[model samples]
Target chain A: MMLFFKECRKILFSLTFLIYLVAVIGFYITQFSHDAEEKISQPMQGCEDYGTIAKEVPELLMPEAAEGLVTEYLSGYYTAYPIGFYKEVKLSEKKSAKIAEIITEITGISKRELDGFSDFDEEGITMIPDGNGGYTPVVKEATLPEINIPDTMTYERFRELMRKADKIIGGGSQYSDDNIVGNFSLVPKTYEDALAEYNDIFEKDKITGAYARLFCDYMGIIVSILPVFAAAALANADRKSRMEHLIYTRKISSVKLVLTRFSALAATLAVPVILLAFIASFSVAKLYPENNTDFLAIPKMSVGWLLPNIMFSTALGMALTEISSQLMAVFVQGALWFGSIMRDTELTGDIGRFTLVCRHNSLYDRNAFMENFNEFLFNRIFYTVLAFIIIALTIWIYSEKRKGGLNVIRKNIIGKSKA
Target chain B: MEKIEIKNVNKYYGKKHALKNITLTIDQGMFGLLGRNGAGKTTLMKTLAGLHQKKNGSITICGIPVENTTEIRSITGYLPQEFSMYPNMNVYEALDYLGTLSGMTRSERKKRIDILLKKVNLTEHQHKKVKALSGGMKRRLGIAQALLHDPKVLIVDEPTAGLDPEERIRFRNLLTDAAEERIVILSTHIVGDIEASCEDIAIMNDGKILWKGTVSELINNARGNVFTVNVPQKYLSQIRKNYIVTGMLIQGDYSTVRIVSDAVPDLQGINTDEPNCEDAYMYCLYQNGCEVQGGDE
Candidate 1:
């Protein structure tokens, strides 16, 4: 325990950790703090925009999903989020025909005619300002030739066809079962729908639950990447200072020493994030003086949603740095983080099972979050367990290094890339 | 008595044989390993300290086999050839951190650090940051850290390599005091360290032990082979090419040269001179049929 504290103190005083803190706090302020505002309002009649809500309406989803599939199939490439990053997959001829078959099954449009339709309009959702001084999403329609679903086709068969299309694109497309509703099922909300959502924010969320999700959404991005810096710096400090032989010769077991050092790195890196959660909770409490607020909401949310990311990233840094070198660890983690951030198209709760940063950027969509809670739960727990597994591997590597057993690693092909 | 024993210990760095078929007995006192830079002295020390593995031979440090690294590390203290502490840590803090890793209790660490700091002559500078320490002071601190655990054996590799004469003398005296109870293994290419302190000395060359005996035995072995010859200055280069010249003093047109040879050189004013540790080491290497690159410089 004393050794852990000493290491924590050393890391807390290091320049890298200071940069980590700044990045975390800076992200909180820029991405989340500025977004702390009055979001819910009673919908008024005759407003230009009431809002948009994702509904699993077969009439609305079948046409849109079929259109998206045919257009991409014609283009001979598909966009996917297979692992939380955008991927452009050019499928084989057999797979392309499979997608065309799914499209023909849904729209009664033959693959030959789908190919003959030279161009299709691009469609997306636009956020427009309503009269209540808040933005509401309005979907834009494509002007391709009209396509209709058969009356005999059931929603289940349509869903099955969508699933086949997702499979054709290699999964994680908007047509996949896990993401279809969040992607192609958005419909404009009626006044009553807006009022119901507004009431859900107060009655169900109790105000802070909604903000907590938003806080985690913004805080999660930086924590997933920043903790790597601290972990790498701490893991490499002994060698950088030429203290490895001194520590290696000690009576302390390698497991104890390496585990204690990781504990310290994880602890120090977590302190500021948890504190920011608390501060965010308190500040959100001030936003709704009349309503009851869950003061523990952000802190609890941070522990569950953000801590796995921090631990996983930190463990990766330690294990990779121990296995190879500090610079490589940072480079690998940076590339992963960058990839994860680059293709995160859906921010209002499309949490995938393998999403590195689970995002819920809205302050009012309690239903969207609860709908995918199972996957979100799996993502967090997997990373938490994986973090420990990596640390265990790190301990083994460190013990071997201390005993001169990792000569192959030290002589790796990276040319002086080993510690 | 607690001692280190080696039985034909061998080590290799990949295909290159480092410590080959080595054998020796080191007891509780100051023992010196005298060799050139690549004589595998560091390899032997590291192997004994559980930092390297022996291929086919056996080594036991006070009955603890070298393979049992945890046990060996607990009882052995090693100071590598190049080392430093976290630069920002004060000397006291650095010692405290190391003592904690040594499994010393809090009170034990506090008390042990005070004694070790003063013993290393860093008492007044205990509060000073490690980066601010001079090279000699850092070497002293290195010894202090190695002794912080109070292990049964201490292995120091080239502890005096980059120190001034004064610091080297102080460090040698410190090691002598440390050797009063436990076995101290000092590995260095500098023969003066062995000459000043060790009684049991071994000379290694090319992964082989050339000679092993008391200081006087080594010097006595080379007594008749050391010759002092008066030669003209112009003949100095020829003598150097023909024989291993250990020392030289120049006169007006003549030079008094000291050379180690198998028999009398064909020169006038030839006399056998008493061999010091340096001359004896060169002569030992020469007698063992190893190349001796010796000169006045």
Candidate 2:
């Protein structure tokens, strides 16, 4: 227990720990503080954009869906997210023809006619009279032939056909099942819709849960990348200070030593995050005392939503540091955090099953979170389990190092660097 | 009551042999391991410290097999050649931390740390940060932390390698005091350290033990073989090439040179001299057909 506290003190006094604390607190105060305040004051107006949500009502308007497909097919290129990475998938001639056929089936527009839709009036450098005084050069907008959707095609049937078209285009087109409806069905929220969402926040989440999700969203980003610094520094500290042999020769078992350090680092890194959670909860409570905010909401969300991120990052940092005996975990964890941030496009919805950072940035989206609640639960549990497993592996590696089996590589690396 | 026993212990770093068929017994006293750089002295010391496992043979500390590392480590204290503690910690804090690692209770650690700081002459600098201390002071603090648990065996590798003459003598005396009750293995390439403090000494080279006996026995092995000759300054280079020169002093037109040879050379003013540990060590390496020149000592 003394060793654990000593290790904690060592980390707390290190420059890396100070830098990490600054980054966490800086991110909280700068990014989320204003959002918390704004959320408290913004009236429940339905005109606010919640981004494009997929609606159950389907309308196969030829101008929106078909024109989009025809334009992409003519260009011979499409943007897609294959395996969660943005890729510009250029289709071959055969796939392009297949897409053209689907476009004709949906809108009764031939591929040749679609290609001939470009009508350009390019008389070079024409000047038109400006209302003020001088004349300004104007480029006239091109007009294309109008295309109409077949009356016999129902919205559901057109959707099925478009889904097939999306599959043929290799799955990142606007017509894909996951993206087709959201791409076309963006409607402004009605006052009734906004009132209903406000009522949902008041009744289901009770305002604290809503704010807690936002807090987790911002805190999750910081926790995912910052704790790694403290962990990697603590793990590599003994080797850097040339104190490994002295500590290894002590009577404490490797498991006990590793677990103590791991817990100490986790606890120390948790301090700033837990404090932020309290401050955020208090701000929400003080700003709107009539809402009867749940005081436990932020704390509960911090543990339930954000703790797994801290655990996984810190444990991975320890494992990687033990294996290489270097601070290589920072790069690996940084790359993982970057990937998670990139994949989170809809912060208010679609919580991924395995993302390191689970973002729900909105103040009130109980239904979207509830839809993926089971997967979110599984993700958290899986990360927690993986954190423990990696910690166990770290303990094993530490023991092997103590037995003088794993230090050969580290010594050779150090030797080469010195040479 | 505590003694370490070894039998044909061998250690290898991949294909390279580090410690070759080493067998020795260490009892309660100050034992010195004298060897040049890469002479397996550190390898042997580490093997005994339980930091490295031997590939073959067995080792036991006070009748407990070395494979039972927890028990072995509980009673052993090791100060590595390149040792340091957390630099941000003060001398007392560093010792307290390591004592915790050694599993000493709070009262035991507090009581022992106070005594060790005083014994290692670090009582006055107890509150100084480790990085703020000088090299010799840091080495002394290393000793203080190593002895915090009062283990039965203390393995100090090159404790006086970088200390000045005054600090070196003080460190030797401290080690001598530590050896009164437990086994102390002081490994160094500097012969003066062993000569000043150690009674039982072993000389090693090329991962093999070249000689092991009392300090007097080692000195006696090369007694008649060591000679001092006064030669002209021009003949100094020839004398260095022909014989193993342990030391040399330039005196105007004449150079006083100490050389080790099997027989007295046909040189004017050649006289047989009493061999010290350094001369004996050079003579031992020469007798083993090893190169003896280009040594710092």
Which candidate has the highest lDDT of all? 1
Q: Largest TM-score belongs to which candidate?
A: 1
TM-score of each: 0.93, 0.85
Where model 1 places Cα greater than 4 Å from the true spot, the runs are A37-40, A45-48, A108-111, A115-146, A151-154, A416-419
After superposition on all C-alphas, the RMSD of every candidate to the true structure, in Å, is 6.0, 5.2
Could you give candidate 2's per-residue lDDT for residues A247-338 as a string of tens digits? Answer: 99999999999999989888888888889889988888887776777888888889988888889999999988887644468878988888
Which has the greatest DockQ? 1
lDDT of each: 0.87, 0.83
Candidate 2 lDDT for residue B162: 80
- Looking at model 2, residue A2 earns an lDDT score of 75
lDDT of 2 at A44: 48
Q: Point out the worst 10-residue segment of candidate 1 chain A by lDDT.
A: A410-419
Clashing pairs in 2: none
